[model samples]
Target chain A: MKSIAIIIKKELRRFFTDRRLLISVFMPGIMIYLLYSLIGNFLFSTPQSQEYKIAVQNPSATFQTVLDGYMQSEEVKDTYSLTVIESDGQAEEKKKELENKELDLLVIFSADFDEKLALYMQGVKPEQLPVMQVYYNALEQSSQSIYTIVTTLYDAMESSLANVFEVAGGNVATESDGFAYMLSTILPMLIMVFLFQGSMMMTPESIAGEKERGTFATMLVTPVSRSAIAVGKIIALSLVASLSGLSSFLGVIFSLPKMAGMSMSGLNIAYGFGDYLLLFANIIVLEMLFVALVSVISAYAHSIKEATAYSTVLMIVVMLVGMVSMVGTLPSALWVYFIPVFNAVVVINQIVTFSVSALGVALTIVANLVCVALLVLLLAKMFNNENIIFGK
Target chain B: MEEILRAEHLRKTFKISAKQRKIERTEERCKVAVNDVSFSAYRGEVFGLLGPNGAGKTTTLRILSTLIGADSGDAIVCGCSVRKQPEEVRKHIGFMTSELKLESFFTPSYLFDFFSELHGVPKEKAMQRKQELFRKFGIDRFAEVKVGDLSTGMKQKASLVISIVQDPELIIFDEPTNGLDVLTAKVVTDFLIELKNMGKSIILSTHIFSLAEKICDRIGIIVDGNMIKEDTLAAITEKRSLEEEFFALYAQIKGENL
Candidate 1:
């Protein structure tokens, strides 16, 4: 145990004292936070306030009332300023303005449109009921948006005039459920990737780099047992990876609300302290599994470069599994929780969404520990293998 | 004399990959690295295994040091069997070789303490030994410098100091002076004599004939993984110079005139 402590201390000192390594450990989190914030600001910022220019050949008071009623909503009230211009035998010129995007919309309402519409609703149909022509440039985003809004209002007005039945919809999910659903989908993939990346940052260089430089043989010639070396390295590396994972976790958590265009204050936070405890416990165990497995792969490699190449393949595999599991339905089977990476991802997803079973969590933690033990054992055995250590 | 180490028919073999086979232009799948090689060293004596490169000198020392396993034999170091109790054997011996390199990032002082802790030396004893060895090897002036920054000779000195941090009874050095300048080579040769005088059993492997004559009490000539001769330096040179005798034996083994 003392020897293991010594090894752990040395490994951690190597990581923490090196400025380059320290930067690598913290850079992922900082970069993620900045990039995600920039994306959120660009993709989900509130619609910009703008004015819409409309040319109406024959302006209708009824249509104006419809637009006014729709604009009363708080979200749209301050977003758009409306202007009405008479066509006055310049319809072609107005179209030219619309084409150039100088005009937002052109509405040509027939004379006596309200009267004809009233007559039509009273079952006295006129020769060709009053018509309205709507034209706007599709090439301009603002013009397209206002055109859609205006057409939607007209459709509603037509539906109300000849209404036989009404349809309405409401979301049954609470605000907290919405937030949880988003987290359950996104955090698993990101966290799994971040945890893997964190392990990759240290394990290959620590194990395989030692081998390449011939230092591993020096360690082997000592009286320390191989298992002690393996355990010490895994524990120390897992601690480092955990720090990185935590950084990324914070970045994700703090940036998520901004990305979704929702105020974090508006969120109905559903997770309790116990939920977080379970999540973090599983995460730490999962990192151990990752570190152990990477150490084994690294021990098999002759150089750090080779180890990194092999580990990149494993990283891709991890990413594919995480991404697929994120979109697929969660498995409730007890045996599913006994798988390694997949199990941890599922358990984390369930924990965030508040549907995790006690048995699943227990099985996942047990499975991760078992896998870690097996991989560490394999690593120790590899350390003892002369060919793997000395072979070209 | 008390026996410090014994080897009975120690052997090791390696599998040649297809690429290596092509490079060497050989059809054999396996190359015997050490074939029925056996020799012994006594306490308070420096034993030399004299051979050209690829004569299995390093491999034999590696097996005895417990860095590798023998295929069908055993070596006992300080009364511990390398085959069965390698960890125990390692505790009884100190091994140094070109293959065992210190981490470049570590200073000699830090590495000394690290290896000393690994060898389970008491803290106070380790500190005293570090001061003595560092000063003796002239490594004290650069003890705080990283291994990578040290000159080749300085690095070798540091490695030598670290190898015996446990003060083991037996010390096995593979090619101790293979890559040193004349001054550093003499320093190392003098150090071996000093170690021998202090009652430590030393195993030295080298190809230099003069090195064998200078300090070795006994010499074993290994050629093609076989121990061709083992005797006191005086007995081996009684009939001819060590170099002339070595070539005569080599001709006899290869069935050619030299």
Candidate 2:
């Protein structure tokens, strides 16, 4: 144990002193935050154009008056600035304009507008109704608003018709805020990616790098058991990997508002200082398991290149498992809590979503620790095998 | 003098697959690496295992260092049988190789301290040994610099310092001066002499005969996994230079093969 501590201390000092390692660990945090923020800015910021050009063919004066009244309504003006093109040729020209993405949506009112409006009021499918050909050349928030406005107009035409001139108002319930949705889903996945990336980059460099630099053989000849050296390396790598994991978590937290465009005003991502501490604890365990796995792979390899190749494939497999599990609904099987990398993704997802059960978290920790122990032992065995150690 | 390291009829046969192509089925058989070789190093003697590349010098060193188990062998290091008491053997021996690498991120002081503590040296004693070694090896000047920043010679010195920090009963070095500059090689050769004089049994394996000729009390020349000749340097060089005797042994073995 004392020897292990000495080894760990030496490893930590080496890690801290290495500029390449420092950058490899921390650069992802900075880059991930910057990339997500840029993407979020593009996703949510309102575009400059607000016009919805509609082409109408010959229409009754009353329908034209209603259309003009609907266009002037506060809701329509707030959501879209409507342009009525006069002729079919003009409508075709406007359709081309909309196709070219000059307009958000194009509403064509034909000669059977009133007839189709009646049919739509009678609960006929909107797509089956011959009322208006609504051509939305662009998909945006305003395009959906225009569809809703047209539906309400059809309903009013069959009823008292007075409500057609009145704007529909009142907030509707949303499934969840964009940030909350993203926090529940995307953040967990990003954590998984970041964790894997950290492990893949650091573990081989920790073990095979030491071997390449001649430090590993120096450690092996000491009185320290091969197991102890393996443990010490796993712990050192886990610490560095966990640091990177925590940095990624913090990066997401700090970059959330900028990336999601939704104010974190009332939204708490459950990743506060306390959560950060817990996350660090979780990450330490996860990283140990990851690094142990990597160490075994690296120990089997003779050089850094071979180790890196093996680790890269391992990391990809782990990442893919995490990714597939993230997008798919959580499996209810109790055994899923015992699988190594898969279990980590499930636990992290639960933690991010604030739905983690104590039992599930405990199982994840226990299972991962057991897996890490097995891998560490395997690595020790490999270390003791001269054929593997000397690349025979 | 007590025998600090011994091997009796040691044989290490590696199972190598004879595969002509990647997809072909292959047969496996024992390809001998160390063939029925036996030798002993007594206290205060610098024993030399002289061999060309692939002559099983490393395999012998590794087996003695407890890094691997021989297929059929009994070895003892400082009264500990390597087969049954490897941990004890590890405790009693200090092993170094030019093939082993030093971590570039750590200073020599840190590496020395790490190995000293690892080998169960008390902190105060370890620090004392560290200071003495740093000064003796001229490593104190760069003790604070990251090992990666040091020259190859400095790294080799650091590696040697760490290897010998425990001051074990037996010290094994395989090609210790393989990559050292002339000055550094001289330092290492002189250091091995000093260690031998201090009553530590040493095994120096290298292709360089001149250094071994100067320091080794007894030389074992291995060729093709076999110890072709084992004798005192003076006995082997009787009426001939060390280089002539080395080649004469090689030529005689080759003539037998022909």
- Best by TM-score, which number? 1
- i-RMS for every candidate (Å) is 0.8, 1.4
Q: What is each model's TM-score for chain A?
A: 0.89, 0.75
True contacts kept of each: 0.82, 0.86
* lDDT by residue (tens digit), candidate 1, B160-193: 8899999999999899888778877876777787
Residue B242 of candidate 1: its Cα lDDT? 89
Going through the candidates in order, their DockQ values are 0.81, 0.71
The DockQ score of candidate 2 comes to 0.71
Q: State how far residue A199 of model 2 sits from its true place (Å).
A: 1.7
Measured by lDDT, the strongest candidate is: 1
In Å, residue B91's CA in model 1 sits off its true spot by: 0.6
Per-residue accuracy of model 1 over A51-80 as CA lDDT, tens digit each: 777778777878778887777777874344
User: Any runs in candidate 1 off by more than 4 Å, and if so which?
Assistant: A56-63, A69-73, A77-99, A106-141, A151-163, A266-268, B179-194
CAPRI band for model 1? high
- What is the lDDT, from 0 to 100, of the residue B141 in candidate 1? 98
